[model samples]
Target: MAQVQVQEDPDREERITMEAIVDAYGSEEQAMGWYYYLDDKITFPFQAKCIQARKVSPLKLGEVVEVTAMAPADDCEREMFVLIRWVDRELAVPLVQLEGIDVDDETEEAIADWHYWMARGYELG
Candidate 1:
């Protein structure tokens, strides 16, 4: 039998981490969109539908919620609805409603790194 050595790329690892983080919270259009903390109450650029803030898990403040999809609201003008995961109920929320919410430190860091990568012209896959 022959022995083989494997090498790793730190940059690639970082990119993979950033990609997973983005995929967990944001959409393809905005990978870092949901990167903020739940406590920050950050506002989204577009409105979401079916969101019930009261129904969010109180104990999962540090957890990340991904926006799976977005669609135009039927009853509103210039408003959109987004579907999020990790909640018990099917909730959509207006993007503006997310303002000022706090997020976990790891998520924040991942977002920052993702942004940095984007600024460097690294197209996120």
Candidate 2:
């Protein structure tokens, strides 16, 4: 774990114009844009810890999971999700719900970027 340099975009106009969503105009397109951006930025098999609890998600606060890959594009037509190795199976958890732990800088920065985006009140789907 190291300090993360997060880039903040606090406005919808800024978010839509981000490199990930510059060509996106609708919700579906923005979702796909974010999906591919994260898929390209994040490195697989990194350890992540649940930072928030969600009723729809099985993960709890402080729970640790090994993140493997991005969930299918269709599945992410709302929010971003990553495939995580859970007990006896794999599950798709919201990317905004987990924080990378002890990962490389690239992976760390990618997650931070998403977190920053959320912290600014941006939403897709």
Most accurate candidate by lDDT: 2
TM-score each candidate.
0.25, 0.84
How many steric clashes between backbone atoms does each model show? Answer: 31, 0
Model 1, 3-79: lDDT tens per residue?
Answer: 22233447744664555344453333343332332112323332222223434323233334555444233411222
| Weakest ten-residue segment in model 2 by summed lDDT | 1-10
**What is the alpha-carbon lDDT for the whole of candidate 2?**
0.82
Number of the top TM-score candidate? 2
Off by over 4 Å in 2: 1-16
Model 2 per-residue lDDT tens digits across residues 9-117: 4563364367678788898888888888888878899999999998879999999999999998988887788999999998998998999989888778778777776
Q: Cα lDDT for residue 97, model 1?
A: 30
